[model samples]
Structure formats: structure tokens, C-alpha cells
Target: MPVIVLEAKDFTSPLFLMRTCAVLSSCTAFSLVASQQSVLEPESNTFRVFCMFTWCFFFILTLLIHILSIIQFHSLIPISWKNLVITVAVLGGLMSFSASVLFPWNVMDRQKVTPRCVAAAVASCLTVLAYASESCVLCIQPHEQRGYMGSTPGLLKILQLWGGCQMIPLIVDVAHGLHGVHAWQLWASGASYSVCVLLSFVTLVVILGDLAGRCLLPFDRFLAGFSLIGVLLYMLATVICFTKILQLRNPGQSSPKIGELFIMETVVSSVTLLAYTVDLAFSIKQLCDRSHM
Candidate 1:
């Protein structure tokens, strides 16, 4: 049964449907994995641990959302209910995406893959689709009525920033391991990533928590300013990654798996750059529109 919305309207909203799907799928994933522990190899417990953590965390948080909405609980919360919902949905989707990839990759190589294990992997993927749908509907379909980071571009920027942060650890590796890269170059690369992450993360906290308008500067200009700086720093980080890091990379000599990791990091960096660039453009446009108004 659908949890009745607090409004007069019946249970017809796509958001509600997606919420239900997310909750159920999350529950199914963790439960399925937990029940069949004997089937999986002991060495492959990392996959089980990660999937269980993602599913359980999502399940608990989403269930809390449903309860909060049903009871109209709002006080003491730092962010708006919808903003919190979107944040959870997007983060949950990312975690589920990771779990889906990790779970299947671990299992597919095993000689004796069980039906139950396959079902658990499928359940993990289902959670991803469910959360992704919820994110799209919340961020795209009715974004204007939502919070600052609720719009399509804004929500996508959050994903981009998160993805970039994930890839930034590769820079840490380069900073430590690069043979020809200078010490100052290593320090600059690491500092660039640190500043970009800290700035972006704090900005997101202010915006999604509805604290942007309360700040001294105009939120639009603040966002635009932040994006501009972020683009520059992210670009600097990418340059260090591709130019300096890759110069030391010897793909022909390294194992194929190690080579693949390098390629994947570079691809993520490129995509992250494009995402931030688009955000910078969008932020500028939004600032201009606000000025005209």
C-alpha cells in the first residue's frame, strides 16, 4: 500500500510512487544479500559489505523521509524536506550504482555463481533505477518549486562535484608516486583538489540547506563566483593529472588492470571537467536573469 500523502490529493504523484519503489527495492537488496551469505566466498565479502551498507543506509534514511512527510515533521531540521529528499535520492543512486557495478563484477568472475547471488545483484541495480527515477522526477519535473540545488542543472552539478571528488583521490596517488613530477607540482596538484573539494562541499551545504539567501553576498553571484573558481581549480587539477601524471604512466609496461584504472580516472576527470564547465555557464546565466528581474 502507498503511504498516503499529507495533502488532500490522492496517492497519484510520481514522486510518491518513486519513493515507494526506492524503499522497497532498497529493502529487497540488503535482505537478499544478507540471507544468502553462505553462497558467497569469504574473500568476496567486500562486495557484500559495501552492498549491505549502501542498501541499509538508504533504506533507513528513506523510511525516515516517509515518516517525516506523513507526520509533517519539520522543526529542528537544517534543510527543507524536499531538498533533503533530493539529496538522499541522488546520493543513494550513486551508492547503488557503485554497489551494482562492484557486486556484479565480483560475482561474474566466480566459477559457481548462484541464482540467489544473481538476484541480489539485480536487486542492487533495481535500487539504482528506482533512485535515479526519483532523482530525475524531483530535480527535473517540478524543480522550480524545490530548493536551490533542486533544478536539473543544479542537481547535476551536485553529482558532478561528487564524482569529481571520487576521482580526486587519484591525484593523491600521483602526488605520492609520480617519478618525474616536481615536489611543488605535487603540492600544487594536491592543494588544488583540496581547495576545490572544500569550497564545493561547503557551498552545497549552504545552498541545499536554504542558507544561501541569508549570506552577505547574493546567492546567484555567490554560486557563479564559486563555479568560476571551481572550474579554474578543477581545470588545474585535470592538467596536472593528464599532463604530469600521464607523463610518468607507462601503460605498455604495467598490467592491463593497472592501465585500465588510469584510463578510467582520466575519463572521469574529463567528464567532471565538462560538468563543472556547464555548471559555470548555467550559473552565469542564472545570475544574469536575476539581475534583469
Candidate 2:
């Protein structure tokens, strides 16, 4: 049997950090939406409109989550922590769903198949959902033991839920990229993207196993570091590949489509990735230290 343990003092900083990230995600979505409005051709092509609608929906949901997070901070909400977690999970699910649909829409057009944009869009969705799950489950107090690694069922369940959801799209995205990449680009950008996906998948698997559950304290710490390092590598690889693809598509940087892709990749995507990097560092350190006590 497992028991859930949480501390109010330990939850605040991560909550605030996640809130800031959500705010940035929402803001960048809005800015991209606004920028695309001028060039959107509702009659000939609906790509811009479709993209804007999806981001608008995601922005509103994130805004709602942000409000809920703030209300929780003020203690104005009478809801329990479980309730708050469920609420965030639901909103985050919706946000991820919206992005998933938009990503495919970006490439559904037979004439324009930008695999790089598709991959970046899909990656952004995964990062957003991962951060959401991380923030929601941040209160699980890490315990240190001499013989076995310590973690709650709740933590593993949350990870499994979000990680499984993100995994499917990553596969589809990689396959999509494979069909279109040049030989040199395939060896370069394509290889990196595939490795990124593999690393993310491996990290998720490593953290959810029985060995992870029963490992020594030092082993648990090592796993946490290992998982985050994989994530950082994935981020770097994805960003580099995405940027290169963007440059190759529009060498002069004059296309509106390129502009939209750039903003989404650099601004909106970076917001979630940077915030998650900070949250994960703080979280792993907190877990190890808490267990030591």
C-alpha cells in the first residue's frame, strides 16, 4: 500500500513557476494569432485561420488554468489538492488536444508539407502537457531510503498518463518527417529528431518501472538527473533541427508562413521548455533533499 504525502510550503514556488510559464504560453499564442490575422486568407486557404483558432482556444484554457492556480494560492478555493490536480489535468488535456489537431492541419495540405513545422508543433504540445503534469503533481514529497528508491503511486500515475499521451504524436511526427527529408538532412536533422524522441521515450520508461520504484536513494537521484538530461538534449536537438528547417524553407525570411513557424517554435515553445527545465531542476533537488531529511 502507498500513502500520499504533500507539503504546502514545498508546493508554492513550483506553482508560481508553472503559472509564469502558462502566462507566457498564453501570451505568445495570442501574439501569434494577432500577427497572422492580417495575412489569413479565409477563402483560398484556411491554414492561418485554423492555426489561430487552435491557439486562441489553447490560450483561453491556459488563462483559465492560470486563474485557478492563482485562486489556489490565495486560498480562496475550497477545493482539495486532488481536485486542483484534476482541474489542471483536464485543462492541460484540452490544450494539448488543440495543438495536436493544429499540428496535423499544418501539413494536411498536399501541396505544402513542412515536416519541420509539424515536428516542432507536436513537440510544443508534448512539452506543454509534460509541464502541466509536473506542476500538478509537484506536492508529492520525495522520501529517501537506504535500500529502495521512494516515490508515490500518484506521481507515477501522473507521469504515465501524460507521457503516454505525448508519445503517440511524437511517433506520428517522426514518421511524417521521414517521408520528406533529404538524404543529408535525414542524416543530420532527422537523426537528431529521432534520437530526441527515443530519449524522451526511454526516460519515461525508466521512471515508471519497478526498478525505479525500489532503487536506492542515490539511484533515484541519478535517475532524476538522467531523465532531465535526456529532456534537455531533446530540447536542444529539436530546436536546432526546427530552426534549420525554417531557414532552408525561406532563405530570405520574407514569407509569412516562415514568420508564424518561427514565432511558434522560438517564443511559444521556448516558454514551456525553459520553464519545465527550471521546474524539473528544482523538483529533483527538492525531492532528494526532502528524502535526506
How does each model score on lDDT? 0.70, 0.46
lDDT of 1 by residue, 175-271 (tens): 4445345677677767766776777787768866778779898877777777787778768767765665365465444544334445555666667
TM-score of each: 0.75, 0.38
Candidate 2 TM-score to native: 0.38
Clash number by candidate, in order:
0, 2
For model 1, the superposed segments whose C-alpha errors exceed 4 Å read 1-13, 31-53, 75-78, 110-116, 140-144, 168-193, 243-253, 289-293
Model 1, clash count? Answer: 0
- lDDT by residue for model 2 (1-293), tens: 33333346634666555655655654564454354323322332344444445456655655665555554452443433333344344445444555555545554443454444444455546537654654445444333311111233233323333433333333334334343333454354335434444544454445433335455555446545644754565476457547545664555534454344334434433443453455466558778688799
Candidate 2 deviant stretches above 4 angstroms:
1-96, 99-196, 199-211, 216-219, 238-242, 245-263, 267-272, 287-292
